[model samples]
Target: MSIFERMKQGATEAARKVEQTVEISKLKSQISTREKEIDRLYARTGKAVYDAYSRGDLSRSETEVMDYCEQLSDLHEDIKLIQEKITNIKLEKSCSACGKIVPVNARFCPDCGKKFPEDDEKPQESTVGEIRVLCAVCGTENDIGARYCVECGNELSPAAGDRSKPNDPAGDSIV
Candidate 1:
């Protein structure tokens, strides 16, 4: 056989091998996708079974299913505790009206416009050197120089002392 013919045959063989490799890779990718889809379906089925068990439609005789459900319940409680810790650390709370996160000191829900009940205890005054101006309307403390209350947007008294009442210009006013 001529050298040119042998070279042509070898090139054709190499091209076929490349095509086979590409086909195999594509098939593997498709298999992986199908496997993921199967996993999702399995999760949905498991959730449905768990829900049924929770609703008392399933019997307690199924100890395996009950154990898994108990584990999930414990995990959910743990998550709730972790979330509460996060909120406390951030000085935030969920608004009862909208379930949206708001500052712990907020007097109203920004999203739902729901007024929060005043706490029995007064808000603690700022530490030494940090002058806070208290709002007469909402009693929310603001920075010394702030013209408006941060929580209620009420006009603040220029004086930080005796914030319960606005400063009277006339000295004749009774204490």
Candidate 2:
């Protein structure tokens, strides 16, 4: 082969390789999305059942059991399709968000708009528990649960030395 022909062939092979990799990555992502959808459907079905049980409504659950069963049947087909797509992928860089192939360590998915799918991005769980307090005076509560009532503007949990009531500017008249 001539020098030009050899160079062109080499370039063509490289381009083909890149194309294959991208196609494979896209296929994997598509499969991941589909599988996630199937999982979500199943979860919803489970939740519906649980809710029926929690409400002590056996009759309603029985009526809806057929619908849930049909959803599970549909999910099987979805899983099959996703598996086929996964098998066809030629390259793999699994997404962290949903566990599937990406074009590279891509920052965002061109297909799904997911950011940093193949990287650890889970938020750290907070260790501090929520705080709530009840006021013993004026029967009003504050969001900060401060030692004072927000509605009536009364100081809460007053010290014994400060137990004396303030002089009423309105002449101590009972309204």
Number of the top-ranking candidate, with TM-score as the measure: 2
- The TM-scores of all predictions, comma-separated, are 0.39, 0.41
Q: Candidate 1's residue-wise lDDT over 4-95, tens digit each?
A: 99899779867865875666566556555655655555575587677777888755435655565565565556556655655554456777
Model 2: per-residue Cα lDDT over 1-175, one tens digit each:
8999989977986787698678777766776776687777677777878888899985666656677677767766776766555544432244445564533323443223356633433232221234433345544323332333433434444221132543345635223
Worst ten in a row by lDDT for model 2: 120-129
Give the poorly placed runs of model 2, Cα more than 4 Å off: 62-65, 85-175
Quote the positional error of residue 40 for candidate 2 in Å: 1.7
Using alpha carbons, what is the TM-score of model 2? 0.41
Q: Pick the candidate with the highest lDDT.
A: 1
